[model samples]
Target: MKLIKWLRNILNYRKFNCRRRALFSLKCCLVCKKPTKRGCNCLNGSIDKGTASLGPCLAIIAVLLILIVSFQYIIQIHPHLVRETSLSTAINVTGVFLWLFVSVLFNHQSCVWISPGYAPKCTDGYSSKYQNVPDEYFKYDPELKNDETVRYCKQCQTEKPWRAHHCRVCNRCILRMDHHCPWIWNCVGFRNQRYFYMFLFYLWVGTFFFIYFGYNRLFELYKVSSCILTFLPTIFCKLEENKIVVMNDNSLSWFNGRRYNDENQWFMFCYYACCGVNAVMLTFLMWNSFLLVNNQTTLESFQNLNAEMRKTRKNKKLRHFKYLYDLGSAQLNIQQVFGSKYYLALLPICYAPIGNGLLFPLRDQVHQIVFADTTNEPPNTKHLKVVTV
Candidate 1:
């Protein structure tokens, strides 16, 4: 009985800790001094600080349900060839399954790296010791006294680069911090951004493929229904009555009309069906491509626009596409978008965060070489240059 009471007490304590941690982590908006709420415009004077309203969630659920039902219907209605030819049908079906598998795998592996504390000491020549000084150097100009001391990260105790921001969630200072991604469960920092981008690209492609296959199946089902209707007893009865009235080689006339009319109807049905499906798939694919080209996730794009509009005070206008033209010229260019040093170290893909897998390893090697002398020397004006690339 005593042991049971002790176990119950321990469980209650754990539950209290969990609630306390959660409340502590709930961030307050810097502008409002209130707990930050998602999908809310507290910054714009809307004070409904509850969780996300059911409207958007319901809409998303409706779309997913519709897709699921439509896919099931198509599969059941057309167990055979959706494409006109057997080979084309087989290829379409195979492509759909393969793309689905790839999409699921990519989504599962998405993650970002974060440094919880101070960065490791620079072994490589890429980071200059002098660069550790704060931006006060630039702000005060050369005439001002150089009072800015190099600040080492309290956690990692290593010198951080300019513009590096500490990610509270990641518990580390990320170089050129963009944002944290919950899907990957990591900070979208210097590394893994490429994989994230590629993952988005592949997902868009796979969705297009699935839609195409679904469309063809829908078309085939429609054609089959029309064909059955055209060759029905009602049509045959009308033809028989006309033949008897004409009474001059009616059999041959009836046979020729049925054969030619049925063939033409089926051909037209198949052609139109293909056209409709292709158009819908093409439109959706273009939208996904547009998102990728801008290097913004759908969620980020929406949030950034919301923030921008709030600042401008022109909330009436919904000009989301205005930012597209500024894509390549933005501070986060294609090179920085893909060429993060950390990503090169972790992921196998060489597309972005360029260079071999040895980048991080080489960084370590260089750090060891440079810091080998442990003797403490008085701070001086000497500059140490480390070539990273």
Candidate 2:
């Protein structure tokens, strides 16, 4: 009987040991207590280190290649094609390319590093953070108590402000989050939303400039080899004032320099790539332009669509769902994203948007819809009084 009891205890100990070992092998982070990715022990609270992925690296490489190749192409080829090697032309072309390149770089960097403002901890209550905000912004159905005036994020344990949403990827609640872009490897939110749009604008312009300037040389293979500089061993090649000569097929003659044909294929490839990229970017830019003019974020647009669909299904009378933040005027909406100095909105400088991400001035209709007593009947848009608290 003693031996059987001892054997049972030994078996239980082994089973417990096996379970502990299995859990340990999972390699959950000591800080966040979440399983690490491929044995990466992340001490930081967040699960993802955005830059570890391939998307951003490829994006950075693409930008660098475009800049380097465009610089060389314009300097070595454009002046010769125009038959004007003037110092002024060289300086002007270089200056324009540099400005575009710098702007794109700045925007890209800003998008990657800038935090998309996080929601503050709501340990006390809503009043602590939103003390100055107008009461209408927090109004909800009092009788139902279903739609709480303020939203609480369970993951971050913070009060979500008016436009705030919890980003599962970042493991924090973001204020006015537009979206998470893998190419930028960051969330586009209140702080870096301006940079996100500016990056698209600059990249579109850059690709356009590339395609426009390089169109003439696209089909002519001989001109491509001579006119376009390539990444190849050029120690044996002869260099004329406006051309490079490399021996191919035993053709040592300087004029017969189609040897770099294979290498120049990238030039043509880049040309068409830019053409396609420019077209897509134009479409994207235009979409963002429409969003900007209407005071909408990408996430908000989707949410609005969902809300509209739900409203349509429930009550046809409430078919039209107006975005509460839109201040009605297009200029005012535009000013919300870019600062009041509307003229400077075109520039790539990192200007702050009008208000903090927390609170926005509500439209009169918004006040009417919000502050009015909750009822089952459809909202009366016309006669409701706009009250301030």
Candidate 3:
């Protein structure tokens, strides 16, 4: 009886030991639990580190090739195109190509460091650390009793840059962020704002050219169709000086002191088709042009402004000429928007002296003042305040 009792106890102990071992093995991490990996706590290194997939590269290359081919064909067919009407077109094509190239380069070279999933710690203008506030406002730092320099990120467990916001999708901080651009595969921040603007400018130009050319072609087609319907069987005949003359599709002839030619008919058909196509294309171009002049992207413009305002209790300001120029001067005109020192360098042409063009200093000055006032405040603070009116 004593031996049997002992044996039963032994069996129970062995089973317990085996269960404990299994539990311990399960808890073991597959990968190293480093702060760098954000406690991935993974055991196997199967998780990707930072490189972008080859698929994006391949897709970009394919798109670029297609654009190049299409551009080549268009240029070949329209070799007689003048720069005046096609200036926008030239800019747009060049801009798109540049964007594509930059996107590819950024995707390949940009780092993919992770940032906090929440905001960073900061002192208010009064030097009070808004600790215990929501993470959206500021992160908390246990060590930062009165030290303004000490900061903490709940998720990142690291210090964030001043004016940095954590991007969940990119899993990192963006500096002086304007926005993220999937087309460029990069953030349109202080560093990349120039490229973004340039891209928009070029796109607008290209769209304009395409519309002009297409409109002309459409008109030409319409004329040819009308002529064929109204003047059939005598399609190659023309009246001159009360005399009818018949001519082939390529030659001129005179009959009864009247002259007619195939060249005239051909010219009419070409002109009509060109005009018709251009008119149709012009409509689409005009819409895009409106968006550019307003300085709003298609996505930004489509957002439900009322809903956004209701949720945030803020009134969104439109990017208009007044907000784009410098306004400290006595001049009170709109030209400041374009002729301000900031934009002067960016203008393609310089026929007029700085601050002396149409709206000149006034436009630029107003925009600058508006931009300064707006920029001084927090991005969501002034803009989010709803007006009763």
- What TM-score do all the candidates reach, one by one? 0.39, 0.66, 0.33
Candidate 1 per-residue C-alpha lDDT over 40-142 given as tens digits, one digit per residue, 9 for 90 to 100: 3232222111111222333344335334433443343234344355867665766655555444344335432222123334524244543444333222111
Model 2 CA deviation exceeding 4 Å by range: 1-52, 55-59, 75-87, 123-149, 220-259, 306-319, 373-389
lDDT of 3: 0.35
The candidate that wins on lDDT is: 2
The candidate, 2 or 3, that scores higher on lDDT is 2
| Evaluation by TM-score, superior candidate among 1 and 2 | 2
lDDT for residue 5 in candidate 1, whole number 0-100: 42
The 10-residue segment with the lowest total lDDT in model 3: 43-52
lDDT of 3 by residue, 1-389 (tens): 42354355445544544344434444553433533332232211112111112223443553464354335325432432334348666566556545544443332222111111123333331123432222322222111223333344445565543234444334455543445544444454423343344444443444344444444433322343223344331233332222234544343334422322343344344333334434543564465444335433333344322343223212123223222222333232112122234454243322222211111112333323323454343232221111110
Instruction: Report the lDDT tens digits of candidate 2 across residue range 14-126.
Output: 44444444444455544447655633433221223322233356567766766766754664356544554577776776678778878888888778777777766663444
Q: Give the candidates in order of TM-score, highest first.
A: 2, 1, 3
